[model samples]
Target: MEAGEHQAVQLCLESGALISTQQHDLSTPVHLACAQGAMDIVRLMFSRQPDQRGASMNATDKEGRTVILLAAARGAWKTVTALLRLDADLSVKDNLRRNLLHHIVLSGGLLDDFHGEINERLKDFGDLLNERDIQGCTAMHYASRNGQLKTIESLLHFGAIVNLKNNENQSPLHFAARYGRYNTVRHLLESKKGHLIINEMDGEGKTPLHIASQNGHTRVVHLLLVKGALLHRDHKGRTPLHYAVTNGFTHTMEQLLAVHSHLLDQSDRDGNTALHLAAMHNKANTASLLLSLSCKISHNEQDFTPIDYALHYKHSEVAMVMVTHPSRSEEVMSCRTKRYTCLVEGLTAVMPEVMMVKHSFQALQNTEGVGDIVPETDQPLPVMNIMVRYGREELLSHPLCVKYLETKWNSYGMYFHMLNLAVYTVFLSFLTTNAVQLMAEKTDRENFTQVTSAQLASAFVYPSTRAKYFLDIMNVLEWTLYISAGLMAAGHLSTAVVDRSNQYIMAALAVFLAWFNYLLYLQRFNRIGLYVVMFLEILSTLLKVMFVFSVLIIAFGLSFHILLAKIDMNVKTPVFDPFTGNVTMRSMNMSDKGFHNPVISLVRVGTMMLGELDFLGTYLRPMRALESSAWYQIVAATWFLVVFIVLMPILLMNLLIGLAVGDIETVRRNAQLKRLTMQVELHTDLERKLPRRILTMVDKTEVYVYPNQKGSSSYVSVPDTKHVFRVHSSYVLRD
Candidate 1:
């Protein structure tokens, strides 16, 4: 049975040897003959075992490969035909439930060779042509996955269903995309049911485009996108764009963006957009590409933006790129109004829009992945502080946003804000008065209690949470109220001298900051707020400037320390020796003391930026003192000061001033709007924290708003002339 030759099988049969129904491996003589495509050996075996023909032909091997099925699958068409003549069971399937066609296609053979009688033999098993494998995949799916284009067409010609789904409900197109078979995918798109299956999703609600994108198959992705494949999300509400961004597939991302740039900003269920994934994955180059394409920096449901993700994940370079990208995207520049239409039934305003657009709405509701968002309009902000905190103040400039600001300001917002500010002033006043008293004052307990109670009540009404407070002013007054209260409490709790000293110091600081914060209250008005807004804008720009110059400052600091740190620069000066009671020349160290510490050295160099050169004290005095030591050291130190002055003070400082001055006009325009946004935020937070019973008791009167309304016009009654010659030229001339 193992030897597949006609003569050997014939000799064995003629000798009257009993024909074994099967071998050890369960392969019979018919199985070996079909496996080798030996039609003569197969016919001899079948004739020799005429009584056992069905048993020999229908028996399966270890892998459950049947005789006739094995022959067809292994391209033994001749032997398959011979087995058919011997009355082989046509309905026999392998253990995998695969039929004759499934075997042939899985063998990766082209069906073009099935001609004449072989073609006739396959047509009788029409149902087998569409029979599914264990995985619910058909022969067409196998052919497509293996890129057997000819075999796919041949199977189609043999009555194969073009859009037949496996148990997985996935079509041949889906299989083709899974393997990145570009040609097969294109052909499937051009097939009879091509359009129907292009966007057809699998059991997981994933489309062929999703599979191709997930695998980073750029060419297949391009073909799918070009074919108008819908940018649908899967059951998880993730789009093809999301899949491509998961692994930083740059080219695939580009293809998806080309077809639907809107998907770039579309968020998944978590509200995370594509850029957030790029940052989280540390795809710096991908982030830069996204920015160049005008992708918006959006916050997800957790209120975290792409930059936040990058910084959190330690992708500093990605954070920098995102932060430096143009704040205004293409969408911002192109913001325009469209003539809106209402989807209503019966062409009447009173008609329920759901009757006309219910199906459309349900489709959107059913769509798991993609959505259209108008964040500034559709998504409501929980608090207004988010705008100023995240530098989203630009949103206040939109026309609709302006209307929201107006409506919010008019509806109890103004009164709430004014009342909140009054409370904050009283709180700051109490903090200041307590701080001014001595640390161990006899009435310290009373003063401390007053301060705490005032702030506690103020916080219950409205907490003055600061956002990006002045960095320089923090040197003296960072969290002044909190620090002062803490020190006062500490002093009251312990009579330690150190605590007492800190109490007085913090007290003095609290008084200064209270005045400063009180001064800022003038910003509540529009005209003064312009200067305050401009100050903050300049301060922000200055922060960026400080960041960029930090490297230069460090470089200069380390160099200054290396060159002059150990130098003995003693200024020779006349001094009185008290012990001897006589005047004498004494050498005094004239070198800058800060050079001993790198931090102090950096501060000294940074101060040069503000025109605090210390030229005479550090450089000139040292040069004079060191003249007697070495002229070379003096020259080097002098030249170093000159270079530092030109770079730090002359160059960057002047440029900063120019930039700050240029911000005036823009500041003037946006200042009022920014203050309004801030005002609304303060009031909103206050109102949200109000007692529920008090809120219930509040007035329910409505405030009507009319946007962009033109001035009303009325006409005066006038007499009309009845006759044609009435009010003729002569009468007009007389008048």
Candidate 2:
């Protein structure tokens, strides 16, 4: 029942199972085998049949397609051959009235044996190639539609008609050209009897060239044009150029325009030219090409020109192109400006002021000098709260616009320098303080030192209050710095005790001081802070991958540890010391820390993941000492080197790098907005600190002072004589 199960079919037939059993699709074992191209199963099943005319061999499925017809349609040459040897029906038709030849042609007959076998069967039926289906499509029609060159040649050799038309009145060339089959079109054109149907029209009155041009088949269009296919109009009175322009096929339009330049002005049933169609569809390149060929811009039946069509569809770029052509017709230019001036007025933010108000008022000379005279109208240019922000290059190149230099605000005053100095001084002081203490500890052992007194005192005074503010990372860091400063003070104050605990406390204090100072420095660059935040966001994903990687390492490390546990050899290991000489000790492995235990193996593998592969000596020394298990240890070490070193670290590390690189641009764009947010916060803080009198004196400033009344209905404050600088409202563009 399954595909390629010839043995199962043989076993069932030899055991005398029913040959006429049907599946849910109403297909028998023969139909199923033929569909799968199971030639052996087909032969086995047909050989067990009771007779040639039995119900199973010549049975039609639900769709009325028999076994051999299904095989022929699927191009199953072996299955078709096996059925033909058993005398299968060759003249049966399906629900679509398609015989064996029709199915072969429709399936393209790509296989040689399949097409040849079907063609040999058709020779006994006498001119089945020209026989009509239900839709009146012959085998040649299907061959042409599917671009089956071999099938076409076979049908032609069998005396198939070349100029047969389907029910849609479309010739083989129409179907070939419409589907962009360049080779099939060429083969049809090269045929002696098929060359005359080049311009034959279908039901829609579209020629092969029209269909090819509409589909944007450049090579087929060129070939059709070279073969004398004309650019005739269809039922809608639209030429091939109209179709090309509407579809934005610039190359096809170029080829057609070279021969038929007058088709540029040809109008359709609605009196819309090719330019109108292109503009309405927002085909800027096609519209520009039409304008370059001097296509006339005229109105449609509704008195709408191409520019109006573009504006009606909100295609501003296309409208701008149509309005700026250098060689545009005088009639088009004269009528376009007044008709679509609303579009130019809508671009007030992007266009220059001179062009925006050019036609509104003319210059008049008063008693003083020439100036703009105001004109009265019922509806002035609507106030634009939102406008298109065109780039500088686009505004500079507009024909009716003149560019003006915009004044830019630069933050280079004393306030900017003071903010920078504050951040830099704090960062440098933290580093300098740590360095000075380190030098004093090394050079002067008798004297004690504390870096800063204020930091030392605040550390012991604010432990409880600082613990309450741990949710804020900055607060937590500040408290950590304070506590670390207190710990360092304690260490220096207790130097006389000379305890080892003091050394450990000093080490932890050093780490906290360095981390707190680094965070302080990062807060200064708000833009870089955004990059840090983005990197932190992907930390969870990296940790998850590391979790999986660790699981794998742990599994493999335990395996290697258990396998190489008893293979260690005692050797002398040297210990490096400053006060004493290098001492040697007898150890079972490198550093007396043999990886015979799983925990030690895991630690070694963890270091190897960070590209520390010095454990090769640990594995090699054990192999050299134990000659019995030397080969197994070498294999285990090699596997460790391959998987943990090459596979995990290199490949997974690169994957993380790729993920970080992909998010870099997104982080950079967001950093700009974050920088602006920081600037707004800094400016607000500065405003709150300044005196009210000085804040009132600032230009483009707004002030809202609530009245000091209690339970009064009218609590709005009015400007009194004492605070005389109050204004209603003003706008300030943040620097």
Best by TM-score: 2
Error of 1 at 82 (Å): 3.6
The local lDDT score (0 to 100) that residue 538 gets in candidate 2 is 59
Candidate 2 lDDT, tens digit per residue, 577-686? 76776665656643344456779988866766677776546565666666665657666766766676666578867876776676776655444333333333333334
Candidate 2 regions with alpha-carbon error over 4 angstroms: 1-24, 39-47, 52-54, 85-87, 110-126, 134-136, 320-674, 685-735
Tens digits of per-residue lDDT for model 1, 1-735: 566656777888898854545678888766777789877766676677777776776779887878888887778776766666666676778888887778778777656655554456665667677778898988888999999988877777777887889888899999999899999999889988889999999999999999999889999999988888888888878899888888778899888888788888888889888888888888767787887887777778887766556545556455434433454323321322121132111112332211111111122123232223323332223334445545676654533344445444545555775786788788887776666566435545776677777766655565434453334353235355555656665566566733666767766766776676666656654456557766776778889988988888998888777666777745666878899999998665524357767788887777767877767766677676565556566567778878888888888788888877876767556665666666655445555566657544642323222211234111111112122111111111211
Number of the predicted model whose lDDT against the real structure is largest: 1
Clashes per candidate (backbone, < 3 Å): 0, 0
